[model samples]
Target chain A: MAADKVFKNRIRRKLIQIAAFGFTNCHAGNFITGKLYNGKFKEFCTPGLNCYSCPAATVSCPIGSLLAVTGRADLKVSFYVWGFLLAIGAVLGRAVCGFLCPFGLIQDLLGAIPVHKFRLPKILTYVKYAVLALMVIIIPTVLILATGRTAPLYCKYICPAGMLEGAIPLLLTHESLRDSASVLFWVKLAILLAVIAGSVFVRRFFCKIGCPLGAIYGLLNKVSLYHLTVDRDKCIDCGKCAGCCPMDVDPVKAPRSAECIRCGACKAVCPKGAITIGFGSGRKAAKREGLVDMNVYSRK
Target chain B: MNKRKVIGIVILIAGIALIAAGVFRGELDVILRKAAVVCMECIGLG
Candidate 1:
């Protein structure tokens, strides 16, 4: 029975990895021809942080799309983009971060490399929200509204995912793109290298501290349909669930913590089978049981 | 049938409808034009 369960878990991880790669790089022609794919699919945004500039990307990154709209002088708020983000957040929350994001997958793989792992300070988790507010929303919006100038501050200056997936590939394939590279390119490259190095020591370092998209989705995790649920009756408070959590979320105390990426690592590790990934009224039940603190609920 | 579920469903439907309306109204043209290029600025070329 244990062997069967292990086999099932392996299969599930493999399937999710395959889905993540396929969804992000579905534009086969772009990869073959070494060009960007401009199609109707490009009109839509993917649930994860796949860069639109990626050669094989058929869809847009929601953060990139939001930044693009925010940088426009004529548009104040993109109802479509905001609505899309809210909808995705309300439904899936950070499950998209866990199972869908190509960059998240890369971080996971890098984290899997044999090394001494360290836990990040819980305070560091709040940085992504600041990135969301400053880099993604506030900076671009203020620039467009105040100066009538558009700048995707996050993508141009901050997004390591865009650097790794889009810039690196384009630089390799198109010499014209290489000519355009400047100091900013080196800065982005340095940031990507730092993020990659951090991933080796800390699981999901970028997702935990830097991804504005993850931060946005994390906000909706409390109200999202899909989330982790803990059964207080079955939980022994063994601390195993908290130990296994890559994102540093304590499932027993806050099953639907904003920091939770819904990787199911806790669920897999729970000896009591108290933690579950499901859609239901588990949030309220946890609240009623006093397992969750109302202050933390609202503060996060 | 919880309050959270009800609110989530409503938001989900509204979001889908909004995106659909935007697409029908040709908001996608903006995205199409942007995606067609390599976005040199985005990749830190500028």
Candidate 2:
């Protein structure tokens, strides 16, 4: 059964990677826009984390949109942008990272290049919160106040997403873009390379350590109305769940651990039908796991 | 489908719908034009 789960995960990972590539590379199709739309600019925005500045992006990045909205002097709200993000995040969670984020998919592919991997110290996880507070929130807000126009600080200065989605594609097509490279771009590129290299040793080093989006999604792990639970009595304590967890969460203690990406690794590894996912009462859930005796439930 | 799967399908469908609406409403085209203008202005390409 564990083997079957592993096999399924492998298949799912491949499918997700392919979908991400198709979504990311959809920019390749936008060149037709030049002829179809008669626009002086060759590119249009594709929505998500993709930079519209990238020669390849058929879509725009959400972070960019948020910045653009905040940057605007007009106080009017953008229902479309906010609605789009909520809908995507609520429906998909960080499934975007697992299934459709182009940059994330690239990182996964690069990590697969076969090299020594690294184990992360649990403490470094706090860095993502700081990143979220500073880059996505404080910096953009400050820029909006100062310039009346805000750039995506994370995307421009720190996001490997931009480097992969925008910088790489544009550079390949526009030679001048390469000559204009700033120290900032190279620094981000270095970070991207380091993360890519680190993924070889660490599973989802970026998501685990740095992705503000993932940090946002992780906040909803328990309350997203879907979560994992352990039937402790049924749990043989075989530790198979931890063995299977790519992020190294101990399921018994932290089934709904924010660190858990909800990849279903622990559930698949539980030999005794110990772990189940649902919205349920914790006591009843504990009973199902045999943590509480059936006799105990009956008395109530 | 499971919750995760349901969410996945919904996002894919909604994304397609939003994109289509933007095209049909002509709003997406307008936004694109605006974005292109801004991008060009930023880079001084036009």
Candidate 3:
């Protein structure tokens, strides 16, 4: 990828992120009036983690909606949200995180603040899986079975996106709501602040450590329709792609690694142009490039 | 298509079917009701 191409990609990504944020949050009037959009559009979910409670949001966060609907003792799990998420993940994988998530955009902007950014420790990167297993899955299931009740614990306790997108806007506009702020709000605010600070120092701290949604999408990265391929026959074992990867993925080594966000940074930096990303079925892109997909899934 | 491609298509079909079933079950209303209102839990309240 040449410098101009990289610049173009970056610009394109930023514009898309901004456009997505606007598209998802287009009910701007709701923000001024401090009211949520109760339109039929709320039935669907944005692919990224935009909060349904956000006044401007036209759709729901699938993770939040899943936990809320599933946690209820009376209702069966709403397969709609799950299916929507699954369909998106199957096609796009973590590309949703890279391109569509409003929260990801916030983190990316924070990461651009002329400051040193550290790659998350590999051990810490696995925390999101544990979070998904525990908070999103096991705990909710256990609570429902034991007490006949469950809650969206992740959104309530740990999701900084919910806090920033849903809570802050509501609180700012509604004095009565602000007056009712509790210890829980303070605690969540503290967590949100910590997450923001962490993002400043470490890229995608929340996505790498706390986002169950990211974990779920990452699981499908290998099989997703849109993905990256590294042409093995292009030669050169250069480590540039790995060095530039925001998610700490070594595209040459693990092109389909669960940690990859498919942001195209690696592809943008690949000197040999061995990387190809976007929508394609199976290894068709690899075959077209006259290269083996480097058997990336086998090694690391 | 290869196995991976087949698998992807299958999963996609399954997903769409599940969504349609959910809609038929009126789960769309459930999501709309939950999402249309201000959620207290999301705001760190009851």
| Candidate maximizing TM-score | 3
Which is superior by lDDT, 1 or 2? 1
- Top candidate, metric DockQ: 3
Question: How well is each residue in B1-46 modelled by candidate 1, as lDDT tens digits?
Answer: 7677888888889888878766665566776777778888777787
Please give the TM-score that candidate 3 achieves against the real structure. 0.93
DockQ versus reference, model 3: 0.76
Ranking by lDDT: 3, 1, 2
Error of 2 at A217 (Å): 0.9
Clashing pairs in 1: none
lDDT of 1 by residue, A1-300 (tens): 434544576468658966877877787666556699887888888888888899989788887777776666666556678788889999999988988888888898899899999898888989999999988888777788889887778999989988988999888888777888888899999999999999999999999999998998898897789988777766788998788788888888898799998877776676655565767545454466454553443211
What is each model's TM-score for chain A?
Answer: 0.90, 0.79, 0.92
Candidate 3 Cα outliers beyond 4 Å, as residue runs: A281-300
Model 2 interface CAPRI class: incorrect
What ordering of candidates by TM-score runs from best to worst?
Answer: 3, 1, 2
